[model samples]
Structures are given as structure tokens and as C-alpha cells.
Target: MIHNKYFSEEQIKTRKQQMSSQWDTVLKTNEAVLIHSGEPIQKPGGLDSTYPFLPHPAYFWLTLRRRETEILLYSKDLGWIEFHKEISNEEIFWEGEKNDILISSQGKNINSLENFLENHRFSRIFHLGQAKDASPEAFELKTLLDKTRRKKDASEVSFIRHIAEIANSGYQKITSVLQPGMTERELQIAYESEIFRNGAHTVPYETIVGSGSNSAILHALPSQKIIKENEFVLVDAGADIFDYCVDVTRTFYSSGEMSSQHKDLYSIVLKAYHECVAMSKAGVFWRDVHIHSAKVITEGLLQLGILKGNLSDLIEKEIVSLFYSHGVGHLVGLRVRDTGQEENLNPKTYFGARLRVDLELEENHLITVEPGCYFMPAILESAYQQKKFYDDINWTELKKWYDIGGVRIEDNILIKNDGNENLTNCIAKTEY
Candidate 1:
């Protein structure tokens, strides 16, 4: 029933109007905007078949229709006008336009764009296209559009929550089937199978299933490498059925009885995750929250004798980044990596630059709060050569736990005025 309502004509129209309403609120008095649904190109080297036509997110959010060469024009004088090409008889014969019944029938022919532009000129034209090949006016409003979309409406929130439930099914399935000598690719297959079985449209990204030492590779592709006993299996994946998608990560230790050392390492990541997520609220600077997450991890490391120094001094020197790389999280919306570029307000340093969003965390803003502690070989080897933190970091202690690989705990968070909601909390972080 929910799936049926998700694709209903009423819901589709409501979403289109939502985009128009947002545009009108942000649009200047004398501005006209053009959102282009990019043209199609065939695959390279004389192939007739084209790559899948994915409409621009801005265009898709507005129209909820995926037609190539479609243009949405907004002007103060004309209100909102959709210039779209009707499905041709030849194309309709091939695939059939079954879903056209839900679309508006009042759109102008796409060919009339030339005349429309000539007659309907405004002070500034905001042209939005693929890869943000947009006019200065459009580029200026990119962050605003991002913010507007980030704050999901009631229905949008429901859709995100529903997809998360399906994703959690996948996570749960992996635990039941987890065993020694199971290949990374096999685990990926098991997880993805459950996601699809639970009614996900598709696995949003290349499913990450890295085990043992390979788990240290953040974006490692699922391979035939065996998931050994007493090591972490890091699975970072999501279920995508609607335009909104959720990015989630869970690290599972293969053995039933995790050693005390491994448990301590994971506890540090969980501690950071809780501290950073607690800071999520309206008007909180995300960068500060991220640094706080690092501080929490640094404190945890100090407790375990991995790093020996004053907490503030270690953080000030960024010795924490040696293990805890990447930001606390980023916005997750239409795209899993749904962060918008903050105009003239980005982190310049090596550590802070990793954070995607610079905006003050706000109500209704849905984001990922993933805190991780990885013992990556490349990063550690380079840091060892640099000899920058010889005293700050206990080299022998760090090497002792190298086999544990990486540990990450991720959950989707919906920000609120006072606090936040954990959207993916239904999925267990640890089984034991």
C-alpha cells in the first residue's frame, strides 16, 4: 500500500509543486530560471545503446518525471512553465509510455525553447544543467536549493524511513549467515539479496564488503578474499527505491567471542559516534561537532594506550587523524553523498577539509553520523616515515592491533530543533 501511494499521481504532483513553491520563495523579483534535463549520449566506440538517462536531481525533484531534453522554466512574469517533448510514436512503440498518465498534459513542446527565451528575457537567467554547468545566477542558488531539498517534508521522511527498514533487513541477514571462510563477495551477495527481496529498487552504491586487513580499505570492492575468524567485516551499503537514499555502515566481527582488545577498539568508535550525534541540533556548527567526535576518539585511544599525550594537545596536533580519518558525516538525500558545496565557507586545513557540509546543523536536515577508527596501512606507514608523532603515538601498541583492521558505526540522523532522531537505529550496531 505504501509502495502504491509512493508512485501515486497525487504524490507525484505534490512533489512537483513542492519544488515550484521552494523556487518561488528563493527566486528574485526579476529572475528567470531554466532547469535542463540533459540530452542523451550513446556509449563510446560506435555503440548504438545509450547509457541510462538520469535526469538532473534538481529537475527530477521538481517534475518527478524522467524525460530527457525536458526543461522547466520559472519566471516572475509567467509563473512556472514546463517545456517538454511528448513521447514520439516510434519511441513509444519500443518501450511504451505507460507512466505518462501521471504527468501533466499542459507542457509546451521542447522545440519552442528558442522563442520562449527570446520573448521572456529577465534581468538574470539562471541556467542549471548537468555537473552544475550552470550560470552564475544558478550557481549562487545551488546551496539554497541544496538546503531546501535537505530538509525533507513529512512524506519524504517516511520514504527515507521505509527504505532504511529494507536496508536493515540486509544487515540482519548478513549476521545470521556470517561464518569463517565466507568470501567478501559472498557476503555482499547475501546482503544485496536481502535488500532486493525486501523491495529495494537497487543497491545505491557499489556494496562495500571488506574483511580482515582489507577492511582498512574504506571503499574496498567486495572480493573473493575470505572473511577470516576474529576480524572485522565492514559493510557499507544502502537501499535506494525513491529519489532519497540512506548510507549506512556496520562492522561485524566474524567470531562469536570478540577479544577484549577488539571490543575496546570498537567501543572507541561507538563513543565518538554517540558524542557527535548528540551535538546534532539546529544552529550547531558541523565542523565543531566533527572535531568533537575526533576528540572523543582521541580520548578513547589515550585510555587504551594507543596514544600517550594531553587530550587537547594531541587533538591540536591532529594526531587523532592518524587513525580516525574522514568527517563525522555529511548530508544524505536524493544522492547518498547528498552534500552541497558551501559557497566561500569550506575548511582549508587537511583535517577539516574532509568534512562535506559547513552549514550549521538545522532542523529537518537528514544526514549520516558515521564515526570510524581505521588502522590503514598506507596512512600509518606514511605517518611513521614523517616521524611527526613518535612520542604522541605508541608505535608498538598501534602495531599490536593492526590485524583488527577498521571499525565504523554509521546511522542516518534527522536533525531537530532540540536534538535529533536516529533514522537507522532500528539496525543493530553490534550483535553481541
Candidate 2:
């Protein structure tokens, strides 16, 4: 039931006023701002007449208004500018007025965006689409915002932890309804239905519902595969609420019993997983976290006999590419890849080095510490054949586990003043 007393109009106004103060510096420098209000595209040839709509997460965070064909305007003179589509009879007939619901419910101004901007006369307009390379100042603003979100204010933490609870609930529902003959798509729908039932409006991204050999593909697209005995099920799904997200992954048995091989891999991956988490805190370079995580995975694989190399050689060669391909994790916020500058762990003389943002860890940063070891053929072959160091890898053992698929564990973390909080913990390893 929707609570009529929840977040009263006055409370929202106060919050918006507070946000305006926070955005003051960014506004003072830029004359005009351009932000998009995303309109979801219709599914191709689907029978549903509903036009799907989702506001861009960033736009939602800045304006607190969720409507299509509207733009947010900001300048030094004007406190805040809200723009909406001009309603005409023809337009209203085709698209019933979205203004009444948006304005009344959200307390946003109902003014035409064109008129708002045309009258203000900013010398230049800046939008992400037109940016070849984002201005350094804009990048700095984004980083500051990232830092702000890292430590969840009481309200932000409450929202994220709440989403984690919903995600955990979805996992529980999936387990109860799961059967050997179910298709991946059907299972995906079941899990997502639970998310919606618990008040989550959108999945942070695509739901990964892989079963059987399909589980080996790290970011597997849900397919027609049926769950089978002695096979693994890897699910990576998330929930986005008020532009904050909880990313969680859990792999478990569909048959309520684990195979010997499955248990072995699970144990190895989980051990490395905990090690990665244990090392995270403020002030540690992310590169150190990444490489240390890689070391644990590499050692675990070497012990599994999937890879054969001296410990240093394996770590140096990154021989574990036969198992893992992607970086441990990225920043998570308004965007799954939250806005930030790319920083490096090593000060190496390389081409991408120039692109790296010499960033130092600071308090109150939200980041995802995900570490996975997947065996993908395209990446595996390239690493072994193209790279000199990886040339000595044991191809025989690698190919055996190549069919074993992959394992990825992800969690959204909040860097605190002294330590960190795992916001996605509720959904991690959800056997309850």
C-alpha cells in the first residue's frame, strides 16, 4: 500500500533545496547544463501496446523528476530550471499528458524546456552526447559526487540495504519454484517478478540466468537451456532504486546437492572472494586490490591443477586469464559504472597510462569488489598464442575446465571513514 504520508511535499522541497546547495559550485562555472530524460524504446514486434519508459538514472538523481521529453536547466542566476514538453491538442491526444502526474506527485515545475532555455540565453550548452572528451572540470565534479555517494548517508544506506533484502527475497523465490525442466527465460521472469513484488521497479541490468554448461559464460544471456542434475546455475542480477543499485551474484546447485567438482570450484572461488573483501578499505590503491585478488584466484586455480606455473610466474604472466578476463569490479552508483576518473595501480610507461586519473583512495567512496575467473575461448586463445609469457600455459588442463564455464562474485561496497560496508551482502550467497 502506498503511504499517503510518506515523503511529504515539504520534505521533498527541503531535499531539493539541499541538493541545489551541493550543486552550487558546478552551476557557478557552467552557463548551461544539458541532461537527458530517457524514454524506453518499445520492444520490436511485441503485442504489448504499452510504450516502456525508464528515466535515465543520472537525470533522475539531478532533477528528481522522471518524465520523457523533458530537460533540466541550471545557471548561476536561476536557482533551478525545470522544463517539460509543451502540450498541444495533437500531442496530448497521441500522448496523454504526463505533466499532471509528474507535477502533482513530484512537485516539479510544468514549463516548456525550449522556452526556459531560449529566454535564459546561455553562451554554450553542454551535454554528454556532444562531449568528445569530457572537460576536466566536469570530470572533477563527477568524482566529487562519487565521493559523496561512497558513504551512504542514513537515507541512501537504508535504500541500498532495502534493495538487497528484496534481491535476497527474489533468490529465495527462485529456489522454491526452480525445477529441472525450466527454461532460463522462464526462471528469469520468476526472479524478476519477485523483485517487482517487493517494490523494485527495474533490474540494475540484464538478469543472468544461466544453467548447465551455459553457466561457464561469465555474462551469459538467458537462453532456452533447461536445468539439469549435476550442473551449476550462475545468477548475476541486481535492483536499481532511486538511482542506487545493489549488484549480487550467487551460484548454487539446482538439484539441492552439490557435485564434487562443483563444490571444489565453489570453495576455491569463495576463498579468493573473501580474501578480496578482507583487503578492501579506504586508502588502498584499487590496483593493489585487483592484483591481490588475481593472485588468490591464480593460486586457487594452480592448486586445482587447471593451471601449472611457478607462483610468481603465474601471477606475473597473469596466466589465470584462461579462467578470468575482466577487472575485479568498478564503481557502482547512478550508473552501474558510476561516474569517475580511471586511475591506475602501477605507474607504468604505457599508452593507457596517460588516460589514467592519478587518483588516491578517499573516504566515502562506493565501489564494487567483484572477482571472477571464467574460461572464455576467444580470450584464452588470444592470451596464450599472442602473448610471450602466456605461451607456456598448460592448454590441456585449461581446455578441460573451459567447458566448466565461469564463476563471478560481486558486491557493492561503501567505503567508510575507517572501514567499509558491504551493501550487497544480503543477496550474496543467499541460501536462506
Candidate-wise lDDT, in order: 0.79, 0.65
Error of 1 at 392 (Å): 1.5
Backbone clashes, each candidate: 0, 5
The residue-by-residue lDDT of candidate 1 on 1-432, one tens digit each, is 343555455665676566667677668787887888788878888476887666677776666667889998877667778898788998889868736232454789998988978776677777776555545556666656666677877767788889999999999999899999889999999999999999887877889988988877889899989888888889999998744688999998898888898899888888888888899998898888887888888889999998897988987888878887788888886778764655636554435337557668789999888888888767787855349887888888888978778888899999999999998888888733
Residues 252-366, candidate 2: write the lDDT tens digits: 6778677667777777777777777777777877767666777888888788876676888877766665566556666776556665454233543211112132344566567
Worst 10 residues of 2 by lDDT: 349-358
Q: Model 2: clashing residue pairs?
A: 150-365, 150-366, 216-405, 216-406, 323-374
lDDT score at residue 53, model 1, on the 0-100 scale: 65
* Residue 54, candidate 2: alpha-carbon lDDT: 64
* Candidate 2 residue spans exceeding 4 A from truth: 1-30, 34-51, 86-151, 241-243, 340-361, 377-392, 428-432
Model 2, position 258, has a per-residue lDDT of 74
